[model samples]
Target: MTVATDTLQAVEAVFAERIEAATALGGSWALFDRDGVVASGGAGIASLDPARPAPGPDTLFRIASCTKSFTAAALLLLRDRGLLDLDATARSFVPEFVPEIPGDLEVDPTVRMLMTMSGGLPTDDPWADREESMTREEFSATLAAGIRCASVPGTGFEYSNLGYAVLGQIIERVSGVAFTDFVTHEFIEPLGLDMRFELSAEEAVPYATGHRRVEGNGWLALPFTGPGVFSAIGGLFASVTSLAAWGSWLAEASTGAERGPLSAASRREMQQLMRVAPKRHTPPALPGAPTPPSPVVYGYGFGLFVEFDDRFGAIVSHSGGYPGFSAHMRWHAASGLGVVAFENATYARVSQGAELALAIVLDAADRVAPVSPSPAPWPATLEASVALSGLVNDWSDVAASAVLATNVGLDVPYDERRATIEAAWAAVGGRTAASRTPVDAECDSPDHLVWFLPGATGRLRVEVRMTPLAEPLAQTFLVKVESPEPSVA
Candidate 1:
């Protein structure tokens, strides 16, 4: 579906405003759907020292922890090959991951636990951010020296960069290649994505430089870290075009679109909620500020955040933050619309801008067309509704039995059910059954339906749900009078 030109401009404006509001040197954004990038633009400068313009679609930016999803996918590929079991102990591959949990529990975390961020390790961010340059041997020795965990293994959500780093080691042990090489060969190359751990100094001449704000010194350019053992946690540098492509491909898992390196099922699995994240308390709203948005509950999937919204369905997203860069990628599962954004500044919180940009497109789409398709009633369920209408009109025990399941009669005897239906019709000013058939039918699921029968004074609301059998029978049936609105008087 084509988004309006005005809507695209509104999207670009979001990022342009963010660069100034968030105090970042420069930033870029892209709006994408299942087809491809719908619109993209950049704002401010890419680097302050060199004074380069804002990054274009192909300009590289460090994605930080967004690389976790890639690390998780590699393990999934190995699992599909029967080379590793998700339930297997982490020590099965790397014996150095003997974490010291509270109460000195003997329970060890499985690879799946780490993937879901439920390995009981404490939230390690800025600390792990600087560990990028540590060599593989140093990482292994650090792990062997005894890593501390905050809670029991597999008990709850704890954002652990250490846990994912262990997964990278596991990948190297099983694939017989470095973690970076495995991801490059298996995912990046196969999918034709332009992503890497680091770019050469000459190659990065035009790349966006990472930065931090110094009180007296404006924006200070930070040096980039080289790839090492911790690269598995948050080490990849990617362009907005590449990041959008990766996110859109994962969103297509629901539609079972073109086959890629990962199977559609495995990709879908990556977006499924595995553990509920801790709730965050919000401060009281100020007098003149806009009302707070509906509460969003978050859960951890394979390597992504699954947010459940009241208006929209499941939304998958992940944010990345390092010393000098911040990034975010998010997509609505039902609509397949998404946004990718990056800022070359520390703790920029560019996600706020991306969220606003996405909300605009989704609201626009909802006005033009349904963001998600509504489910239709099954053919058998429609037939059953017709039969039910006839039974209500004629009141034959045999006819009612044919339309309903045996449990319907056992739960509420047929005699009482018929009496209820007759009383409801009488209240609607109908002595005899109305000639009108069912109208305004709607379905929440294929097996369930709600419709109305017009009466003289009011209408009778009928709701029915079918059994789950080859030849389904009406398992739930209800009829009640819905009176017209009361007069203003």
Candidate 2:
């Protein structure tokens, strides 16, 4: 898909505007499609090093907890190889990970629990960020000593860095390779991502220094911490350019696109919403302010959050926060478009910036071409649609038996549907034609078909929804006139 030059400029303008609004010391951002970076840019300094380099598009910033998805991917790869069972007790892989429920209550959290952040571990960002360099021995010793729990294993969502650290151990024990080595060799290198948890000074020339900003003054620079044992959880340093590649791989793979280190199916599986995060009590968007981050009822997948917008579709994203670095990457499953942003300031809340940028990209794309839903995937759906299209003119046994959903008559009488559709057909040139909507296909499982027909006033819009039965049945059939009037009459 070719993005016009003007569209790219509009996206870049929105990105820069968000950055300036945030007043971040320095940052970089990029827009990505399923294939790779569509466009990338950076403003300000990457770091306060003596060289004082201006921000470069390829500059690396510690992705912090965003590394969990990489860790999740590594474990998923290992799971596919049958080296271990994800559903089995995590203690089976890391004996030190036995749940520390009170009164010797032994809760067996499965490896899956760790991946989904559902393990009984408490949230430990501040503590875990500093524990990046912990050795396998140190981790084992600490786990052996038992850990605190907020709830029972597999109970609910609680972001646990220690849980991911345990997963790193499982990867090491199962793959006979260090977690970093496993990810670097298996995912990073093969994906052509210039990514790492460790960087030598010479290689770090483009790295961003974490910052502590002081309002009305300046900011304090913090030295970057090299890779550590817990690096598996929140230790990656990546450029927006590199993350664009990663995000593109994930977005494309979701479409069952047959290219990537991991199978498209597995990558898509890793993105499924395994658990819904607890609802946050966030304030509503201010009347005139830039749209606040979409009110998120977050759902956790392998390492990322799956946010479903009633208007859009599934969005896969993760935010990283270390001492002085913050970052976020987000993508739409339907559009295969993504935004990646990184900041040097501590807890910079850059994720919101990425979110607002995403809203802008979505608006820009919609402006370019109003989106439409894809044709139904099930074979019967097309047959059903053809059969249902017959109803536009008049209802018949052939169309009803072949296409009508079981409840069509009970829900809305055929007389009403026929009149409504016939009027819409008359209003919209009195003829109907079915064609795909420009919108991206929804990456979901409900059988659906969307198309529009030209009309006199505006256009006649038709939608068909169905069940996934072998002989699928249309569940809901809608036909309406697209105009200021909201009613179907």
Candidate 3:
């Protein structure tokens, strides 16, 4: 699917505004679909001291917690190789994981719980962010000493960098390799991505210098953390283009067959809602104002976020924030359309910009043409719709029988059903050539269709569902006459 050029320009406008509003040293963004990154742009400068120019799509920036998704995927790959079990306790591999819990609790959290952020560990942000360089021995000793739990194992939602740190140890024990090496060898290399655990001085690539505002005075460049046990929690650096490509691959899992490094099924599992997060407060309704759109429901998956919106369906996303870097990647699952953005500023909240840009793209797409519920309707279903259209234009018992399933006549007698059809069609100006032709036809699935038939006084809305037999027939039909709006004098 392709976004319109005007929509792409609107996306660039959002990032331009975001750079200034978020006070980032540099920012880059890209629009992606199932195909790949279709449009990209950047604003501001990469570094203030060195005085570099604005980063393009290929510039690298620390994607903090976004690295958790990679960590999760690596574990899934190990599972696929029959080397691990998600249901097993973390202690199964890392015997050092003996965190303190309430007296009544009987078991440690499972691997899945940790992956879903429901492992009951406290929500540690900047605190854990500073622990990125903790040595393996130090992490093991910390775990053996029994850290406190915010909730009982497998009981609640609490973001835990420590829990993920344990996951890194599991990968190490199972794969007999460093956490970063496993991710690099399994995912990054297989996908041909240029992402790295740390920015290398040897490589000739443009790297953004992360910064933070100091007491409303000016931006301060922050030092980069080296990789260690907590690297699994968040360590990888990526570019807008490469990250957008990665987001596209994950979003397309539902559209096609599985690809290796990670199966499509497993990729989709990473995006599913594993634990429901707490709801955000909504403002009160106003008297004479339009109803607010449905509130978005947030949930955590395997290192990813699953959000539900009444207007846009399921959205999969994740945001990362470290001392001086912010990153976000979000995609509409239904359309396989998304946005990935990066900003070299602490807690910049670039997600707000990405969300707005995607909304603008989706709205423009609807105006262009109705978004199909799936790729395309089945050929036989399309043929059945044509036959039904002919039946509407001129009623025929044999033609109706051929087009519809046997249940159609049994549910409602032919005479009664025929009368309903004729009356509805006549209300829409008695089926002129234009009135008989279907318009704006779309499918909920390959076997179900909805369309509009225009008329002078009204329009007829038609809907049909096909049976699940080898040779499917329309098992259900609905016809409604929608009257035209009254003209103002």
Against the hidden reference, what TM-scores do the models get?
0.93, 0.80, 0.79
lDDT of each: 0.85, 0.76, 0.83
> What TM-score would candidate 2 get against the native?
0.80
Give the alpha carbon lDDT tens digit for every residue of 1-489 in model 2: 566676566555654665576556788888888878877787767666667686667888888888888998898888788787889988888877766675557788899988998987899888888898887788888988877788888878899998888888889889999888889999999888888878766663577878887777677877767665788888888999998888899889857787867888889988899988975433333233335345345689998888876556678899999888888899888888889988888888778667777776776676777432543356676666566655655667566756776787778887777777677767666653432222222323447775555544567556677876777788877777767656462
**Candidate 3 on 44-106: residue-level lDDT in tens?**
888885656579999999999999999999999899899999999999898878777877577
Residues 1-489, candidate 1, lDDT per residue (tens digit)?
677997787777777867767568888888899877877888888887555655888889999999999998999999999999999999889998898889988989999999999998999898999998889889989999999989999999999999999999999999999999999999999988989998775673457889999998787889999998889988999989899999989998889985689998999999999989975332332232222223378889998988776777688889999988999999989988999999999989887777777777887887888887668899999999999887666688999889899998998898888888888777778843553588888887999998888877877888899999999999998777765533110
Number of the top candidate by lDDT?
Answer: 1
Please give the range of 10 consecutive residues that has the lowest summed lDDT in model 1: 284-293
Superposed by TM-score, candidate 2 places the C-alpha of residue 67 at a distance from the truth, in angstroms, of: 1.0
